[model samples]
Target: MKAIVLYQQGGIDKLTYTDYATPEISETEILVQVEACAINRLDLRARQDRPEVDPFPHILGSDIAGVVADIGPRVSEISVGDRVVLSPNISCGQCNDCTDGNENLCSRQKLIGFHTNGGYAEYVAAPANNAIFIDQSLDFSSAAAIPIAYLTAWHMLITRAKIQPGEDVLILSVGSGVGSAGLQIAKLTGCRVFATASSDQKLQIARQMGADFTVNYKKVDFSQFVLDQTNGRGVNVVLEHVGQATWQQSITSLAKNGRLVTCGVTTGNEGQIDIRKMYQKQLSLLGSALGSSSELRTIIQLANNGMLNPIVDQTLPLSKAQLGHQILEDRSNFGKICLSPTLSAE
Candidate 1:
């Protein structure tokens, strides 16, 4: 099978479209013929500096939608030719966290692309438990766009923050996949959504997506904007993932007793916070990881029901995945970048 394989981590030049051996699934795993795979910021960081446990000659894509080409002997529910998407997080089913329906917190959790080989190839294998059959109406690209970003957004707002209707919430990086999903999620609760972006064009789309207010962080100080808009009351919740660069400001933008949930630190780690302000405000700071399998199922159901829609901005063939990475790095695209593994010539 042909795949975009990286023998070493550094820049886009490390990725090469080449042939690799097809994986042999274990008794409980299934083989999927990759249709579409979504590019994420994690892919960018991985290319720059591969994470621990990542092996060389690695295939780097997390969210995927594909057809089941084969199933292992123990796989019962899934069948050949079923259209499906895999939940990126793999957890041991018998663990305490898994039994408690908190699979995202499982001690043995492994995110597909990060801890294992992923879907940036013509064919890939995954645990049968991780595959959720999708309705025929949804395309591979849209399905591929759901797992990581939407699940993370859903978990951040719905589970961790426990956002309620009429509450005010601020979403950072309104053009990001998570930001776009966060805007819709907040609107679903009838909450007033405040969004931030680096440009007018992205801010306009945020407004269209039901953001009550949009700020260009490049031009104005977003924390002050939030305070001014709310008359110094701040928002009930703040969805922050941009890490060190936005940490203190995100804390500053929160209302009294407000919840702040974060998933990633794209900027840099090691953010500082004022101990006095934290105690005085009585704020709740939470760290969110990839969501549970149940949350992924809910997002899938919502997508199937046409309530949730993932924004896939553009797609490139598997052979041209380097270009997709460049688009993400440059932050030029709005929603997501998809790769069609089937488009690669063998």
Candidate 2:
């Protein structure tokens, strides 16, 4: 098998496409012939060895769309030759959080491409439970974009914040995959959505995705815009994934009793907050991780029904996985960057 292996974590240069041994599937696992994979911010962080380091020669791609080559014993729901999308979140099904239907909070949780080998290869082994069968109507590239970004946004907005209709929602970095997903979800909930982007081109895309208001953060203060738009009341909810860079402002741009949910911190993770303001405003801060399998299923249904759509910036062969990472790191793309592993020539 040919894979984009991280010989040593540092930069995009470390991601080399090379021949590697195919993984042997466990009795409870399935062998998936990789079709497409998506690049994520976590991939950049993993490449730089910031959060942590995966073992050398690591395959780093979380969201995947592929065909099942073989199914392990006891996997009764799905069978071989099934077109599927990887769930990305792997959790201990018997844990307390998992039993409580909060698998995203499970103590034994591990994200593929982060904690274990991922789908940056021609084939990979995954637990049968982590495979979601895609409807034949969907393409592999679109299926590959769903697992991480959409699921994360769904969990943060719907599950964590419980966003309501007629409310106002502010999303940071609206050009991002999760940000685009957040915009669509907020609009679907009948909320007036405001989004911030670094460029006017990106802001236009955000507006097209259903954001009621778009702010070019490069030219104006987004916090002021939010306050002015809400007549000094601030938004009802803030979708914050950009982290420390926007953390304080996100809190400040919220209405009284507003909910703020965050998933990742791309910028350095150190921000000061006003405790007095938090207390006086009665603000609620929530931290969300990857979403549950049920949430992924719901997102799939939404995609199928045309209620939600994954924004794909570009598609490349898996051999150019490093290039995909570069594009993501530079923020040069509007949405998810996809890699087709099957197209790689070993």
Candidate 3:
């Protein structure tokens, strides 16, 4: 099997494309023939320094859409040749959090590609239960773009913030995968969306995706722009993932009793808050992780129904995984960047 194996994490150069043994499935696992895999910012951090990379020669890709090439003896629900997308979160189903449908909070949860070997290869193995069936009409690349970005956005806006129709919602960095997904989800829920980006081109793209207002954070204060747009009332919900860089502004951009749900810390992690202002405004600061498997299922259904479209800015061959990481590092893409084993690097 051809794979992007990381012998030791350092830089993009460490991601070497080479032949490796195909993964073997346990009784409860399934071997998937990789069709498409999506690159994420997490991949870059893991490649650089985030101590979660396990075992030697790790394969890094969590958003995977592929066909079931073989199944374990105990895997009865899925069979060979099934078109599927593997849920990135692997949790202990018997835990209290898992039983309560909050598997993202389970103590025993493991993220694919981070805690285990993942889909940067011709074939990879995953738990059979993690496989979500996709419609025959749904393309693999699109399905591959859903797990991390869309799932996190859905959990943040729909489950955590509980945004309502006609409300004003603010989405930061509307060009990245999760950011773009958040923009779509806010628009789908009938909210007036305020999006922020680093470039005019990304802002234009955000407008095309239903953002009511767009601001270039590089040029102006985004929170002030949101306030001005909303007539000083600010927004009801702020989808904040960029950490320390935007934390103060995100809090300032929120209305009284506004909810700010965050998922990632692409910037520095530590953030300070004005305790007096937080109490006076009655603001709610929420932290969200990836998402539950059930939420992933809902995202897949939405994609299948065409209610939510996973934006693919570009697709490269699996052999070009280093280039994919470089694109993410530069933050040059408007949406998800995918890698396909079926494509030729040339």
Candidate 4:
């Protein structure tokens, strides 16, 4: 199998496209023939340095949608030729957190692509239970976009923040995968959305997606803009994933008793808060990681029914994984960028 193998983490140039042995499935795992895989910011981070890249010659891609090519002896639920999307989170089912339905919080959880070889290749092996069947009508690229971006956004806004109808919500980096997904989720829940992006084009797209207010953060203090828009009350919830760069503003843009949920920190991780203001406002700060497989199933159902759509900005051949990483690094895309292994020859 041909794969983009990372011998060492440093630059995009380190990602070598070469032939490697196909992964062998264990008794409880299945081998998937890669159809489409989505590029994520995490891929870029792992490519540089993240400490989790193990066993050298690693393959990095977590959002995977593929066909079951081979099933393990113990994998009775999944069959070969099944159209599926692999849940990126692999957790110990016997752990307390897992038994309590908090698999995302399981201390022994291992993320696909980060902790093991991922979908940057023609074939990859995953736990059989991690595979979720998707409607054939849904394209592989679209299914590939759902696992990480949609699941994270769903967990943040729906599960963590617990946003309600008619409330105001602010989403940072509105052009990102999580940001775009959050926008759709907020709109479906009947919330008035405030979105921030670095460019006017992205802001325009947000407005098209039912964002009530859009701001070019590069031009002004988005927090002040949110305050002005909401008549100084701020939003009920703030979907914050940009980390230290927007931490203070996200905190300031929240209303009294507002919930601030964050998933990632693309720009460094240290942020200071005014303890007095936090207490006075009764603000809630929440940290989120990937969501449970059950949540991913709900997300897939929504996608299948057309209630939620995965916004795909573009598709690149698997061989051009380097270019895909570069696009994400440039932040030039409005939504998820996908890689199709079937298009590699093209």
Error of 2 at 167 (Å): 0.7
State the displacement of the C-alpha of residue 284, model 4, in Å, after optimal TM-score superposition.
0.8
Per-residue CA lDDT of model 4 for 1-346, tens digit only, reads 9899999999989989899999999999999999999999989989998997765789998999999999989889988999999999999999999998889999999989999899999999999999999998899999999999999999999999998999999999999999999999999999999999999999999998899999999999999999999899999999999999999999999999999999988888999999999999999999999898889999999999999989999888889988999999899998899988789455
lDDT of 3: 0.93
Over 1-346, each residue of candidate 2 has an lDDT whose tens digit, in order, gives 9898888888788999899999888889999999999988988888887555555668888999999998888788888899999999889999889988889989888888888889899998899999988888888888898899999999999999999999999999998989988888888889999999999999988877788988998898899999998899999999998888888889889999999999988887787779898989999999999888999999998887777778889889998887898888888788899999766444
Rank the models by lDDT, top first. Answer: 4, 3, 1, 2
Tens-digit lDDT track for model 3 on 219-261? 9999999988888999999999899999999999999999999
Q: TM-scores, in order shown?
A: 0.97, 0.96, 0.99, 0.98
lDDT of 2 at 306: 74
Q: Each candidate: RMSD to true structure? A: 1.5, 1.6, 0.8, 0.9
Q: Which stretches of candidate 3 lie over 4 Å from their true place?
A: none
Candidate 1, residue 262: the lDDT equals 94
* Residue-by-residue lDDT tens digits, candidate 1, 1-346: 9888989888998889899999889999999999999999988888788566376778888999999999999999999999999999888889988999999999988888778889889888899999998998888999999998899999999999999999999999988988888888889878999999999999988887788899999999999999999999999999998999999889999999989999989898888888888889899999998888988999899898888878888778999988999998888777888999766435
Error of 1 at 224 (Å): 1.0
Question: Model 4: residues >4 Å from true position, as ranges?
Answer: none
What TM-score would candidate 4 get against the native?
A: 0.98
In candidate 4, which residue pairs get closer than 3 Å at backbone N, Cα or C atoms, i.e. clash?
none
Q: Looking at candidate 4, what is the lDDT of residue 145?
A: 93
